[model samples]
Target: MQVCNVCREQTPKYKCPTCKIRYCSVGCYKKHKDSCLPVQPPEPSGPEVKPASSSAVCTDPWSVEDLLNEDDIIDKVPVEKLQLLGRSDQLRDLLRNPHLRQLLRSVDAADSKEDAMKAAMQEPLFVEFSDCCLNIVEDGTAPTHT
Candidate 1:
């Protein structure tokens, strides 16, 4: 039994002529051709040549720390960490955090920003109070009948 190249299912066939991979079915062969990375010829591996320095006579290779650059700070601290320092108005920072973005979007109302924010905070309080009253009435936790 031949195995599918894409999904690894068993079938009667063994070869895919289009992608040149062993496939169990036409579907497997087609899927492989659609998404596989293009095969490239292997390049000969050799030691890289370094440019001759005229003035510097140091004989040792410099560590990554020696290559300290402005870009290095960004590479060191992830984008998520930098976002922590950004203001609320920074959309780049907000969008990067889906939870934050969702919270903001959920709060946005047609009225003024202040009103929208106040309303957003009130929703949880309202739900909590409603649930407490409901449970008390349903479970006879409170003396309600008169």
Candidate 2:
């Protein structure tokens, strides 16, 4: 459990949207917000080389790698395989569905993610979305729809 960045006491239940700093309560947030600074990406160590793949260039400083590293899942999936997700037409098509998007948001925001995922699995659209992503990442090919 992460302690509040501001109070350094209680376990944090919320993260500041701007800086992504954890805080326990409204009071801690109020105290921290004024001094909060958005995290900047580390500067390149060498001469900047343009990415070979368009999908490799992220407009935001934060990338999927950062999120995966935070969750400690970076090693489970190769960066190459993860990049296939962006190139997947089937996955992109699935993401176009609003209901699937809502399910994804619910899963991401839920207090109990396991329970939320279990519920999401009950929906065929969500299952299809998951399968699409898996197919792309695992095989580097989109699932062909009939």
Candidate 3:
């Protein structure tokens, strides 16, 4: 059983094939997509090639860490594929917030992993807020301030 990253709920479930991050459900999976999407790697060079030799490095990204790292989770999506994620209106709005944009900029510019993660977590309510937005979008609903 793996623990859900968002809620920390423990359950047996499938993991994201690219990120190897486990989620209890689709809701939880989509919750992480915003942040997770940025880290996906680029596709391998050259046309889709098959190998007759065992020495060839497989173009498949997920296949490596499963055997190499054993416990570490790494995202394995192509860089081109990742660019499409930023096209969403939800993501665009989030990026428009000045503070968030600044924090994201700092995180991207950070030289250390620790600093990057710290910067990324600046808005502690981000995940929950994102969840609420997703629920609204999915249910064809909207929030009312009145």
Models 1 onward score TM values of: 0.23, 0.48, 0.33
What CA root-mean-square deviation does each model show from the true structure? 23.6, 9.7, 13.2
Model 3 per-residue lDDT tens digits across residues 1-146: 34777568756254566677666677887787777753466798878767778866444444554544433344333445445444455655665678766665676556564567655655664554456445555544444434
Order the candidate numbers by lDDT, best to worst.
2, 3, 1
Candidate 1 ranges with C-alpha deviation above 4 Å: 11-20, 44-146
Write model 2 residue lDDT over 1-146, tens digit each, in one string. 56778989987666665677767789998998789898785899999999999987655434454454453322367778888787776777888899999999998778667699999999999998888787777776655545
Residue 140 displacement in candidate 3 (angstroms): 19
Best by TM-score: 2
Off by over 4 Å in 3: 1-74, 125-146
Per-model C-alpha lDDT, please? 0.47, 0.76, 0.58
Order of quality (TM-score): 2, 3, 1
Instruction: Decide which is better by TM-score, 2 or 3.
Output: 2
Clashes of each: 0, 0, 0
The alpha-carbon lDDT assigned to residue 31 of candidate 1 equals 68
